[model samples]
Each structure stands twice: as C-alpha cells, then as structure tokens.
Target: MSNIGNYIKLLRESKNYSQRKLSLISKVSNATINRVESGISMPDPDTLKKLAPALGASYEKFMAIAGYLTGENSANNHNYTTGGNLLLKEEMEAIDLISHIKDKNLRTWITDPSSIDYIVFAKKLSDMGIDPDFVYNEFVSRIMKKNRE
Candidate 1:
C-alpha cells in the first residue's frame, strides 16, 4: 500500500512546490506539511481540504487515501469502489432512514440500493425532511413512466 506522506511528497514535487511554498498556497503550516511528507504524521480534514486544491488533487480522493474515508479495498466497505456492492457511510445513513418505512412495497423496490448514490440521496432526504415513501414512490413513478415511453 502507498503511504499518505509519500503521496503528498510526490504531489508536491510534481507541482514544483517547496514546503514553504506549498504552505503559503495551501494555507497549511510548513510544520504540518513537513511532518506529513516525512511520514511522521497526517493532516486533519480541514488541512487536507486546503492542501488538495493547492496540489491539484480532489479533497475527497485525498481523504479517502488518508483513511478518513473508505478506500477501494478497505474492510469498512464504504462504497469507495464503483464495482463492488459496498455500503458507504452515507448509504448506512440512508439505510437507517429507509428502515423506518412502514410500507413493505416501497422498501422492497428500493432494495440493495447498490445502484443508488446514497451520499446524495441521504443528503436530499435529510434536507427536505421528506418521507422515504415519497422518495421511493417518486423513483417508482419515474421508472414506470420510462417504461411507458
């Protein structure tokens, strides 16, 4: 497995950034970057966010690499991969909410949910405070409509 520090170093080098330069750009402290690159420590979530764009990398992808989020092969199975039937952090939350659905038909239609991007789904559900049945019925309606066309 590749180390987070090594990846940081490589990314910094590719960007032609010295530790101080990277700190200046990323708003991360030089000491923190040094410790991270030297494999002595890792950055926190906030620090990783600043450093990622500065290094032209995705913050989410970086967090995943740092083990804050799930990796492709991780046992946590947090849907880091595309092909696997992994239930991600968000998916787990979605499952929790969906479990409250009293209607069996709606529940079964939404089964597996492996094809759903639970991250987005859960956020929308939470934000609107909408009932799961409404969401499920909407999805079912869409499918049925598409079938007719």
Candidate 2:
C-alpha cells in the first residue's frame, strides 16, 4: 500500500513518540499525523522537512520514500552491496508479498527480519538462475493459491 506511511509509522514508533508528541515536536497537527499514518494522506515536502529531524531520520530518506526524489539521488540510500538496512529493498518486496498470505497466522513471520536469511535467499535465487523478482512473484502466487483453496 503506502510505503511512505508505513515508513513514517516505523520511524515514529522506533523513537517511542506518541502521535501527540510527534505533532508537537514536528509542528505537524495530530490530525494530519493520524491521517498520514492511516494512509489517507501523504505529507508535503515541507511537512517531511519538519518530521524527519523530529523522528531522527534523514530528510532525503523521507523524501525518497515519499517519491519526491528517486532513491538513487540520495547518497544515504541503501546501496546494492552494503550500507544501512542491507536488506531493505528485498525486505520491502517481501513485506509487499506477505499481504497475499490469506492465512493470517502464516503472515506473522514475514515482517520479522530474523526469520529470513537474506544471504541464503539471494544466493539460492542466483544459483537457481532465478531473478529475485520472480521469487517474489512466485511467493505471492503460492500464497494466493492457498487463499483460493
């Protein structure tokens, strides 16, 4: 759904800030913050500027998440080989794929980074001559099949 909204919520929660507190610190209204969290709206660049520092995250990260700029434009973004959140792009795809897992119980582990071995996943995909994207689609397809059963 809304990566930006999910990212904002993740940032806010990591800081242990309540919506009311974030609103006060960022000068963003509580209602606006709530709406953004609910995925009902996206914040403007100005709002992002205020919120990023308040949340202790980089503005470029938020702007890139918001689609204001492509991730490639930001030096702080995850590099293919290394940097912060080494699995972010892959993990994000995994998160998107989990929505297809209709059995709510089975979906629980998808968001847990520790549950996956990204190195093995990548190596196996490569060894199989499979594209990472293909595995993502296949995982979702398998989940959909379960839903149909």
Candidate 3:
C-alpha cells in the first residue's frame, strides 16, 4: 500500500473509526476510501482536503504525502512535480482556489475539465494575463506568513 494509504488507515484505526464512519464524516464514498487505502487509487486534491480534517491531519501534510505539494513552501515552488513531468501550474492554482469556495457543488463543477463552468473559469484566468512567477512568489509569501501566525 502507498504511504498515504497506510497513514490514513493507521489514523482511522487509531481513532476507532470504521471505513463507513470515515466515509460519513469525510463525505467521501466508502468504496473510494477502500480503494485509496488499498492503494488501488490515489485520492485527488479535493478528496485529500476532505480526508485531512476527518483524519486529524493538516491539508498541507496530506498534499505533501500525496506528492501534490512540497513540504517546504510549496506555494512558492512551481517546480513541484509528479510522474516525471512538471505538474500543471493551473492545476495547483485550481486546487488552492477551490479550497476557499463555500459551495461544494460549485467547487466540484469548476474542477471538472469537461464542465462549461470550468471552461469559462479557465478562460477568465487566461484573459487576466497574470504572471505565473509573480503569483507563485506571492502565494508562497502568504503561506509563509500564515504559518508564522
């Protein structure tokens, strides 16, 4: 099993939580949790966000374990990668952006690449002409500041 899967299983066992219980608390399906625990599938960013609080862990910690974010100032590092290719800058921004969204359905809809909402959102960001490097540095700075709080 993957390190993350083992970690989650251990945490669940320690908390005396059944898979069904975790599913209920995390709002992630029991079958998906089982698949994640068995290493048959890796949980995505949204799943990690849900499971982290339920597992009594930090979202950043889980993201690091899942190879989504670097342990050190991940927001600052656009070079963070997985599967040998540079991870998409847009995907990282999407994950961070979705985390703050209050509407669960909207978050899911925006994350779906095939959705019209996702297309429009992506278009908006593209039209902004934002500088990636500046954004990365600013995001990292904010995270560092938050950690100091």
Candidate 4:
C-alpha cells in the first residue's frame, strides 16, 4: 500500500474513526476520503491538513506521509552528512531553519544536537522546496555579511 494510504488507515484505526466519520470531521467529502484511502487520488495540501486533525495525526506527520505519497523519495537514497564534522555554515543554517518551524516536535527533532535523522528530515525539507545546502549557505552568508558590516 502507498505510504499515504497506510498512514491514513493507521491514523483512522488508531483514532477509531471510520471513513465516513473522518470525512464528516474533516469536512472533506466521503468520496475524497475514499479516494485517498484507496490510493486513487492524492489529496491537495489544504485537504490533507484538514484531514490530519480528524485522524488525530499532527500536520508534520501528514506532511511526511505526503512526501512519501508524492514519490519525493523514490529517486533518491537517504543520504546525509553526519558527525561532528559538519561545517559551521551548515550548522548555523540548520539552526536558523529549525527556529522557523513552529511545530515544537519537528523543531526539536531538527535542532537536537544529537539523534538527527538528516536523511528523512532533509527529504522532507526538499519535498517542501528547501535545499538543505542552499538554506545553510543563505544563513551563513547573511551572518557573514552582517559581521563584515
């Protein structure tokens, strides 16, 4: 089964919500819910957000599942640089971007000094149109420019 479908099913079951019940709570049509659950259609971001709360899943989890559903990782292996060898530029950028995430759990995961899942996390960021390297560079560039002023 597709990851989105699996996630929907898992959340639904976990929340004790049937397809119809979820549809009602999310204000999405039953057909839309069915389509998503059956892997027949990909829900748009707005619909996905509405459905997340209905299924008792956080928006971050929904976004992750959506990334998987849209084939965001299909062509890429989970590659990430790790260890204390990370450049100062990358570290500062990570800190800046992590600060912008309003979701506490996701922010914590992104900023934690240890136990970072760069592969999955980076994939998620890329799916959202954020290039990790680019973000790091931008953050560092801004800081450097500031210091030179």
TM-score of each: 0.47, 0.55, 0.49, 0.45
- Give the best candidate by TM-score: 2
RMSD of each: 15.5, 10.3, 15.9, 13.5
Tell me the lDDT of model 4 at 13.
Answer: 53
Candidate with better TM-score, 1 vs 4: 1
lDDT for every model? 0.66, 0.67, 0.67, 0.60
For candidate 3, give the lDDT. Answer: 0.67
Question: How good is model 4 by TM-score?
Answer: 0.45
For all candidates, the clash counts are: 0, 0, 0, 0
TM-score of 1: 0.47
- Residue-level lDDT of model 2, residues 25-60, one tens digit each, is 999999988888778998899999999889876676
lDDT of 1 by residue, 8-117 (tens): 66557655689999999999999999998776887788988899889875566567667777545445544334354343555444444554556655554543333245
As a whole number from 0 to 100, the lDDT of residue 37 in candidate 4 is: 72
